[model samples]
Target: MFKLLKYADKYKFYAFLCPVLMIGEVVFELLIPQVMANIVETIRLTDTADAAVQSAAVNDIFLYGGKMLILALCSLFCGSLAARIGSIAGMGFGASLRLGLMEKIQTFSFSNIDRFSTASLITRMTTDVNTVQNTFLMLVRGFFRAPIMLITALVICIRKSPDIAKVFAVALPIIILFLAIFAPIAIKRFRAMLKKFDGFNASIQENFTNIRVVKAFVRTDYEKEKFKKSNDALTAAAIHAEKIMVLGEPALILLMYFTITAIVIIATKSIAEQTLDVGEFTAIFTYAFQILTSFLFTIMILVQVFMAEASAKRIGEVLYETPDIKDPENPEETVSDGSIEFKNVSFSYGKGSDVIKNVSFKINSGEMVGIMGATGSSKSSLVQLIPRLYDATSGEVLVGGKNVKDYSVYGLREAVSMVLQKNVLFSGTIADNLRWGDKNATDEELKNACEIADALSFVESFPDGFNTDLGQGGVNVSGGQKQRLCIARAILKKPKILILDDSTSAVDTATDARIRASLRRLAPNTTKIIIAQRISSVSDCDKIIILDGGSISDIGTHEELLSRSEIYRDIYEAQQKGCDDFDSVGGAS
Candidate 1:
């Protein structure tokens, strides 16, 4: 936890002022009891005296009372100031910690992100960070005030009567032992509680992200049950932790009451024997409360610390996580062209077996290449290598005659624009979402790119045209429309290499053909790589590669593959039969 404090270095002045001012508050508080003792002793001495003596006694009472009031006011002022400073320091630390965590997450490669679940990351950034911030505020204020106040009050009590102070020696150890034994149990429970929180968050996130599927399947009851299970687990864990923490309060209170009773009995005997004065006895009792109350405050602070300990560890994990992929010491600033080569490239998603094994391929600049594979054949994995999303496990992937590792990650990614199979779009107007590819693109550029993707006609048919809003995940658009918009967005990049990973699968055949034609006309020099399930999508490409079981089985033009490659021939025949069946059904209807 202390290691994370470096983020708060900029707020050192406020951090320091908080504790220093708290010490002032404690000093004033300690003086108040002493002043009250003086006032009590003066009154006792003046009892049954002459009128003048009584008058003098009244003046002494006023004097001591005034001193007590001043001390109290000073203490109040100092405490309020300390609280303000502590709040500033604590809030500033949280802001810094959040920024640091977010920046670290942004640097993570795909592999790094896969190591931590999205729900867990969200909990660490929000709930865990909040716990640490609240704990920091408590430490700056109560952590300092308790110990200093305890020591000062203890010293004064011992000075008044050593015998009575010995009672604390007995009570203090019992309190310490109780905390030592139970605090760990509570901390362990808190840790378990945080894990439950992660589960709960995961359940909610999954349900909401797939709400459409859930409702379509009429499985809302199942989702509710899943969420309830997670919610119940979290509640159970929190209750268990709170039960253990609550035990401390009652035990402390019992010990405090017992000690106070002992002190009162002992002080009565001393006063009767003339060994301790009435005024001195009163002050000892006041000091005893102060000391024990400080101890009670300390215990509460320790409880908060234990709660934050789990959060601190979670936050530290994110901050200290190293990205598996990093830029070189001196990286190339530019990719010369879109030419790409994979030399014996193999990759594993951390499993022992490679998903893409001993794969070797080459595509010259300006060539249209198509990748064909069955499900789980690692076709998408192959194209992802071009952008360096995940590094090859064993061999080199080269872009523009240079190893991908030699180029800066940002520069390499900027040069290769990919429309992923998922076709995600942020919540924004059509023009805004397209601008993600090139922020400075003009309205004409957006329209031109949309036209190239065969999206302009539909876009213009809407009353809002390019200004139409796309709700979250483009929920407002049809699947085919979403795919075209994503393609348009990618086209606006004017990248050196363009990859479409089943991006046109949702569109009709004629629309898909028009899109392919537009790409050839508008980006004749850009290297195009297309991955598709339909053989028609890739039959027109300059060359096609077939993957089977993580290895390339054949490579050739469409007609050459139909003659020699069994897999390509089989797929083409199957797609032709499906289209014929669809046409027959339409005619009969």
Candidate 2:
């Protein structure tokens, strides 16, 4: 909980001001009864003393009553101001926390980001943060004020009447007993409930992300069953938590009832025995009500504290997590030469077998090298290492003869641009998406990149041209067009090393050939590493490397591979057979 409280440090002055206002409000509230008691005693005059004496007493009571009313109004005004200040402080705290968490997320390395579930991260940032903020506000207003009010009431009661103080002392022990019996139980149940909530959230996220697959497979019933199971577990857990939390309230109320009854009976006996005055009885009754109000607030504070503790722990986990890929305290500057070397490189996600084992390679400036492999051959994983997305388990990855990890991530990524196979496009205009790679890119620069990627024709056809608004994930465009746009964005970067990882899979063979030709002619000075599945795609490359399983099976030009590499020859032959079969079917039709 202290971890979250640190967010309030910036607004410490406001936090202090809130308590001052609360104490003032409590002080005013406590004075109102004393004023009322004076008015009551003055009005209940016994022998109707001399007319002047009675008149003077009445005037004094009226003066006391006015002072009390004014004090009550002051308290009310202070409370209202406190609420406004507290809310503003809370909003500021929440905004700062949310921004800090988001920045932390952005700084995380790719491997560290992959460790967390997307849905869980979203929930922590939004729902859990909101819960903590709400608890903070409640603590500032109700939690802080309750104890002050209880303490003041206790002091006044002891000073004014010992009998009433004795009753409070007896009641205190009972409430303490209630705490001993239920506080731990409630805490245990609430923790279980929060765990169940995490499971419920994960289930909902899975169902939503896979909704299309579920519908296509006609597994709606199966999904519903899964949802029901999660829902039932959450419901049972929540019920248990609520039951435990509510237990204290009933026990508290019962204690108040019995205490009040005993105090009333004792006061009645004292009055009959000529040991208590009517005014004293009136004052004691008021004190008893104050005690009840104080205890009720205490229990409510306990509940908020319990829930806040749980939320604070979850938020702390994300904020304190150190990314697996750490930057050096003093990172070295990187000079862009576009040379890459992987020296005896080996990597695994964890303790599992290596995904890329004993891989070694060196590419000179402006060389166009291609990596060809079947799925799960670690082609994507290999390129991922070049940008230091994930560190190698052993051995060295170097850029321009310097260890990659020694360079700051920003300096390294600035010189390397990669267009991935997934082809992600954000919701924005064509210009907006292109600007992600080079924020200051002009209209002419964008057009040139689009032209190189063979995307100019379709983009020019759009109603808005460069200003065309792309739907989420570029859903408004065709798959081929999305791939072309991502390619164009990468091209606009004009990076020292350009990586295209199966980026042309969606484009037709003719368009792919056109794009490759355009790049070869225009980007001759850019070091390029192309990963592709089609043999035809990389046939013209200066060199090609074929990965079988996790190790490189062959490395040479197209002609050299066809002559010497069985895996390459077999893949080429299989693809030719597929084409022939397609041509035969078309002829038959």
Instruction: Name the top TM-score candidate.
Output: 1
In the order shown, what is each candidate's alpha-carbon RMSD? Answer: 2.1, 2.8
- 347-456, model 2: which lDDT tens digit per residue? 99866889999999888878888899889999999988988888999889988778889888887888788998666999999989999989999899999999999999
Clashing pairs in model 1, backbone N/Cα/C closer than 3 A: none
Which residue pairs overlap in candidate 2's backbone? none
lDDT for each candidate structure: 0.91, 0.83
**190-215 in candidate 1: lDDT tens per residue?**
88998999999999988999999999
Model 2 scores a C-alpha lDDT of: 0.83
